[model samples]
Target: MKSKILLNLSLFALLISSLGTSLHAQTYGKNGMVVSDHHLSSEVGVSILKKGGNAIDAAVATALSLAVTHPEAGNIGGGGFIVFMKADGDVTTFDFREKAPLAASPTMFLDENGEIRDNSNHKGLLSVGVPGTVAGLYQAHQKYGKLPWGELVQPAIDQAKNGFPMSFGLYRAALQVSKRDSSYDILQNFFRGPDGEVVAPGELWKQPALAQTLEAIRDQGRDGFYKGAVAEEIERYMKANGGIITQEDLAKYEAVERKPVKTTFKDFEIFSMPPPSSGGVALIEIMNLMEEADISKIEFNSTAYVHLVAEAMRRAFADRAEFLGDPDFNPEMPIDHLISKDFAKSRFENLDLTQASKSDSSKFGQLYGGDHTTHFSVIDKDGNAISLTYTLENSYGAGMGSDKLGFIFNNEMGDFNPVPGITTSTGQIGSDPNLVAPEKRMLSSMTPTIVAKDHKPYLVIGSPGGRTIINTVFQTVLNVLAYDMRIDRAIEAMKIHHQWLPDRILYERNLLSPDTRDALEAMGHTLIPTTNIGVLMGITYDARLRAYVGAADSASEDGAAKGY
Candidate 1:
């Protein structure tokens, strides 16, 4: 077994090097049976695949392992959503989003001046939501995993216990870590170094508290994290820092199970996490509208093609802001009604190819709904695939550290409305339905998704950015499905993004044609060139070949998608 695993790992490493050698563009990939957000992380999954574990086993292991290896972005302390598709065509949705604290009210973030305060909602205790990461992981494993839970979790434990060398990705991402709107007191102690500066990257960092916490979870199951000493530490940290989280809040948190939004696009059946996430709904709306238009005949990346899709995105985003939310709280999310062919046509017909619509026109017009989201997708060799997205609302999450736990708590509450606001639901001034409330999950923009072609799953793609998540994921998918690019070619392909707000189409500098930008501008669409489009992690599969093709974006200087 050791020899076989070592051989597979070596073969995988060789594959990555060969693939990377051709790219001065800073891209990454390895052709294999497995793929992940980071090449090294992908190698971890490949090792598990070699050791007789399926993708779920390897994915669960790698997902947890990312905490130690990819600590700059996510960890066990953060919460997210997971959508699993089994080889047998079974699918499950796990909503492990952070729930609001019991003490939270609609007006929690309102100050004496009756205005929303960033610090009040983004840091300290009020920002920490009831975490569901542990529960979510367990739920995924319990249903689809083959490896023993403890064994699967051990990789993260070992990495946390015995620190891993920091990679360039961490070193660079460290530069962008945001402090709380107002620095947290504990945060001062949390990230400070021997010289009283924020700890720099390439430093050998280990979260002993996080290691201990993971160990306890290993020994005690989900209870160890959510209902035990770990929860106590989180609550205590909140109080000590003037935050509002409490024990009851932690105890009441539950990872939700929602129906995966099902849609038919091209030759495939698609399943995605539904609202409180507008990603799925908006994606469907975009698809429904685009499918009615013959885009391929126009040309890939042509002025007209970009114009049509960008316009579709605009309209869909507008509808997103006006109608989408946590379905349980908002009775009129209009998900089904909106995505329905007739309804989509009404909205779609309102679009103009000759002129870009105003920001006031799209569903996701104000869709900066949440920025705390990130994603990872995994496929079991058995043909089961999972799309998972998690976040802490922003960089380093609330910037308040339970350093003893070796992880930052989230400011996901900032995702909520600050005041009792008007909404069609409740039809009165109250918690905007998304306002912080005990056990209520915050909204998100993380859009981790997989597409099937010809009744077979063909692609797994997702991105990490606030509103950019939608456009990044959308454009990448089109590159493969519409353009038929290989996995490496498809993912390394440049990104293009447009949001309803700002009325600007943010172009990844230098990647697109000057004509494309000019075309958009001519249509009255505002275009802004950006330094980095956004980092993307995607795996494109070839069903006939019965193999996996994957790539990570180099566009952001993030080494994450490079597979070892």
Candidate 2:
């Protein structure tokens, strides 16, 4: 009887484990490409790849489909960063980060008392930044795309015309809305039907407005979004709501090319967005510091290894706060002083094996994001790879929706400095250089990277966790090169981070050992255990087979690792 009971108990446990796995295994298509995060968006990309499109074509398709499917984050109303590498070792960066309107004054958000209005005059017209995504994607496709422009955009239009089944991620984001001012009637209509209950996952969610906007773009191309009537509607909406966005701002909007920040680790040369993107340059600095350590020799997840890496992160972040800024505007960005070999060495001078550093000096308190974002990486048979990250600055940005555009607007302007007296004519604001200006771009921590060995592309990776994005990319690369873990295993194994804020070392449990934890505690380091850092995805080339290797975050039951 006792033996039978034990057997039954074991069987019950096995059944439970299997059920959990099935619950989270995100859907994928038959061969070709894989989609994770939101099942439908991934499928949109996979559909294009299966249709004989290259990564560039698929990206445009996936991105536009996301507009109809995952409007909360996958957006047309927002903008982002893209990094691409061609087979010949040529690299480029596209900066469509939203721009302030021409009428945007440095003091636009200031009240009579001189304090910045909450969210910088949050809501109505003042909430949006000039959108760059349509233009940004258009530029990449024009240069590198193989499929017909209209062909790539068709999937998005169809999905929008019909609709897509929503998922938990979308519904959960809607149920937990914040800082949302539904001042406009169309905006209030987004989160629910007339019943006022939350929309259910897998329910068909359609945005006819989004379909119309994409249709206009499909008919006229990039001009439809930037210089045409669609652009006019956006401007009209803004100007009516006290927004300073003008026809001139819409006309003047252009996606300029910024330099890509790059470095090398072991066999691979890593490249990412430069300057204004604090994410990439900071990644280089952390890599420079971590290069001094032998990561693999130590026990995996041993406290000593964790402590060293976390300390390097703290130091690098301190420098990021003090030295980095947007180059075009500030013009004084100390690139040499920030990622310089000498500067990185100078940051390591204190080199304590023990204590966490205060972000107080860094002047950035906990940047617990009040936002939502997404990332996707693509590799074609031709050795072309792209890692792109885009956002509305926060989920359901400014909590305002565009009635005409069939999308929500970005409140990226809040990312700017809010002080009335303090100005950014210099672009240097102690540590917060990402602050706002008229037609100015905000600083973002979105790091999109590609790694190469001997001038040949090897791996392309990127993530979307705001400040955590830098550390996540750093550790993933370390796992692949120094730790020698397969790319998938490296991303899945575990993660820990220290953003130089409270000096508290944050990490996940079970992956790091008790012995390592005690050692760090002995050194006066306060450790934080956290899980679900966010999604990390990429495709790696298997040189021997000339095939592909890919991975996706599996925190959700609905994630997949698909490729051909």
Candidate 3:
């Protein structure tokens, strides 16, 4: 059995290298599977599964593991949403997204002159939100976890305490930080040595502080961090840095359980995170528009098909910028209207087909809604599946951590529109529903989704790419379900994205041919080349074989899909 597993991994690695992606992108395992952007984190989850844990247990383990092995995207200092399906056919969602501090205000990021404040919401302690990751994971475990909480988090604790070798992926992620800038406190604190040197790849790095932090949370449950020493440490740093998060805010933080948005496309049920995450609404709208237009008629990856996808993406994002926000803060969002087939049809009719819409064109849009966020998908032998996407908002988050506690804070407040109701060059008011507000969660595009066919788990998927997340997942779904590509091909295929305001179609550098770019340009679409848009981590289940197929985005440098 061990030999067979090793052989499969070897073959998978070869296959991945043939595709010109990192060997870390190789697929692994059949019975139970874990796919994440970090190999160590994925292994941690696989270990949990081997220890008789369920999909939820694997997910929580993977998330915690990433907080240590892949801090660029995974983080305890951040928060995200989780969507899962139980073996008995029940689907659920948990929204543990960070919220604005009590002292937050709608105009807090606005200057005295009523203009947007420079970097006010992007950097420093003022940009931090009340983190909900610890609460979110704990709540999920309390309800569904099959393993003890301490057991689930033990792998992460060990990794932090004993140290792990920094992989090429961690090296690249660390390189993204500007070590010279001491103001980037989180980045500096994470990668810089006390002597002002930077940690490099292949080195064994340990974080005893983070290990101790995790151990406390394991021993005392949620209060260990939120109401005790950790909370006090966080408050002290904020006070010293002109930030407003208080112990009261930490004690009051709660992860909410919300209804998953459910919809159908060609007989498959799509389940996704609802609001605070514009992801589900926007994704549903885009899929509905594609269904209404029958976009499958065009050849896959052809300019025509890519153009259709890009147009659909643009329309969805335009709607998102207008309507999607924290439901509690913007209760008037037309959730029903936006996700309706009628709305998709109306929006589709405005498309010219022969040419791109003018850049400045104004239209009422129903769209839905990554950064250094990490995402993972887990499936256990019991048929339970979990899709989770979590983040620190940006690389290292807030570019600083609590000096005493040695953990970073999420810059989620940066997600809110700093200056609401401002007119843009596109002639539409920018970010109305998503404006800053006290105790309100910021709007996000992290779409942790699970899709089913015949009431069985078919696909579990999510990604990390800031605003590009929704579209990346959107295209991947199309690649597999609509175009009939294999899961690996669906993940490796060149992708394109378009957000309405930017009015430029962003495509992988070599994915589209010169002629394709010219054809798109001739059709009035502006095309821009980019190295990457996002990394998608996912797994699909084959009921007939009772096997799980895993995949990680080739665009990423490190990730693994392993199962046992």
What lDDT tens digits, residue by residue, belong to model 1 across residues 1-564? Answer: 999887656655544452343322323223334444455565567667667677677777777777666654566767878777767676768888777777778777787877767666765667677777888888777876777888877777887776554444555555445343446444454444556665554444455667898888888878878778988987887777787777777777777777778677567676777877777777777777766775556687778887888788877766666666677678766678877777767876777878887764312245333453556666655666767777766766766667677777777777665555433221112235455566666667677777876544578777777777877777777777667777666666666666666567777688789977887788898888886654666666655555665665664332343332
User: Candidate 3 — which residues are off by over 4 angstroms?
Assistant: 1-28, 175-178, 192-197, 359-370, 426-429
Please provide TM-scores, in order, for all candidate models, with all chains considered together: 0.87, 0.86, 0.92
Error of 3 at 162 (Å): 0.3
- Give the range of the ten consecutive residues with the poorest summed lDDT in model 3: 361-370
Query: Which prediction has more favorable lDDT, 2 or 3?
Result: 3
Worst 10 residues of 2 by lDDT: 421-430
lDDT tens readout by residue for model 2, 159-250: 87676555566567666662244564355667564366665664555667778888888887788888778878877877677677777887
Off by over 4 Å in 1: 1-33, 175-203, 361-364, 369-372, 420-433, 556-564
Give model 2 RMSD, 1 decimal: 7.1
Ranking by lDDT: 3, 2, 1
Q: Evaluated with TM-score, which candidate comes out highest?
A: 3
Local distance difference test scores for all models: 0.66, 0.69, 0.82
